[model samples]
Target: MHFLLSMFPSSIHPHLHPHPHPTTFCCRNAVLEDLLEGGTPKPLKTGTTIAGVVFKSGVVLGADTRATSSEVVANKTCTKIHHITPNIYCCGAGTAADTQKTTDLLSSNLSIFSLNSGRKPRVLMAVNILQDMLYRYRGQIGAHLILGGVDCTGHHLYTVGPHGSMSKVPYLAMGSGDLAALGILEDRFKPDMELEEAQLLVRDSIHAGIMSDLGSGNNIDMCVITAQGVEYIRPYQESEYSDQRRRKYKHHPGTTGVLEEEVVPLKLEVVEETVQRMDTL
Candidate 1:
């Protein structure tokens, strides 16, 4: 809750010293005009993509790890989604450094709330506060954020970004893959859908993004927030669909698992080797 801790000595970076304007401007609460005068970063050629959907049980969000520089994917295992609170989570796709810093800011704000209120604020309240904070810093480089969480009241999902804009929806997508993913979501989402159905909707949206968005691919990381708490579902490539894709195109192995699953089967080769080695011992 106590923010602005002196984590390190305030020493100017060697590279930043030359570009004093950008550093000084950002360090202070400069107006948006001063920030945007610098020009927007080219809509990142590469980043992550995220989709969120609401269901009766709660809400679900999914994202993929595919970092691109212009048109080519540079890293296949970048994490686009992260847990911000025990019951709340955020998935994002945008400038990596910006996203991380923004998320950290939000996390600190939430901690402050817990300290001030003596109770966890609801998801919608947190989203509103976060959106306002981002808006206040509108001149600073922005990040696209999709937030999801579950509380005794119900489920919540929202998208926030540019100029402090925020929209709550049954579903939403962001990043280069947003267009394709939105199309998939439009066709599949239904009001009052069940948890399983919602999961499928988000999953398909993520897959469609991977196919269409050059900056998004590799594997998907999903999170489910319900009455129980926040549960993460990682990209699983051991299923029939994964096997089929493996036969057709190569997939980076590291992108295959993010969420801990209910029943992960041990590889037969590894099991056999373990048993044989145990017998010898």
Candidate 2:
């Protein structure tokens, strides 16, 4: 025992020393404290629904008109469809500013390219430029877009992601409410659809998104691109949800008896004023 005590400190003697109890402090509270000091994190308000599809002779693009800031609706009628060229149009999602600036930049670049080449820019050309720009930024640009157009090659439809990923499809959808919209598109879409059928499909898809997502509402905008020409519709359809007052709950005067009535009269006092002049040298 003496030898063991001499080898190890008396306070740490194996047999005599008590094992330390596990700490009762919670690590979660510490993390919460640190987060609280920094203030509650705000939810990102980037919400939209944009989609596109290719038909027999043309392509149709659709989008919702609601812009949100957190839980607040910022713009009820904001345009998500952007013009890339006479024949090319884009429907954008994600950050509104990013999509707007990105499409604007692409439009300007395509316009300049057309001027230099003396021919209208191709859909593939626009896709390439957009993918390259987004790739260089490494997904920092929050622009999810659907590019559709009619060119000499044929009608084209492509979905572009913020990370520079691109896909060519007969139909595509993007944004917070994309799942709902895509559900409708996948169910009704068919090969070689007529122009009217394609328009209705696109409209119904957007309506589904609006009905499903609070962030996607207000109205629907569409653009049709064909070899003949382009038709840009500001509001192809209006929202079915409207504020309607069923009945007015107005009450006539003296509907309720006055518990007690009191009236006070105002008193006014008038004072006469005299003007005096002072002489100065």
- Which structure among the candidates has the greatest TM-score? 2
Q: Give the worst 10-residue stretch by lDDT in candidate 2.
A: 20-29
Q: Show model 1 residue runs off by greater than 4 Å.
A: 1-43, 237-281
Pairs that clash in candidate 2:
none
Superposed model 2: Cα runs more than 4 Å off: 1-43, 244-281
**Global Cα lDDT for candidate 1:** 0.73
TM-score of each: 0.68, 0.73
TM-score of 2: 0.73
lDDT of 2 at 24: 12
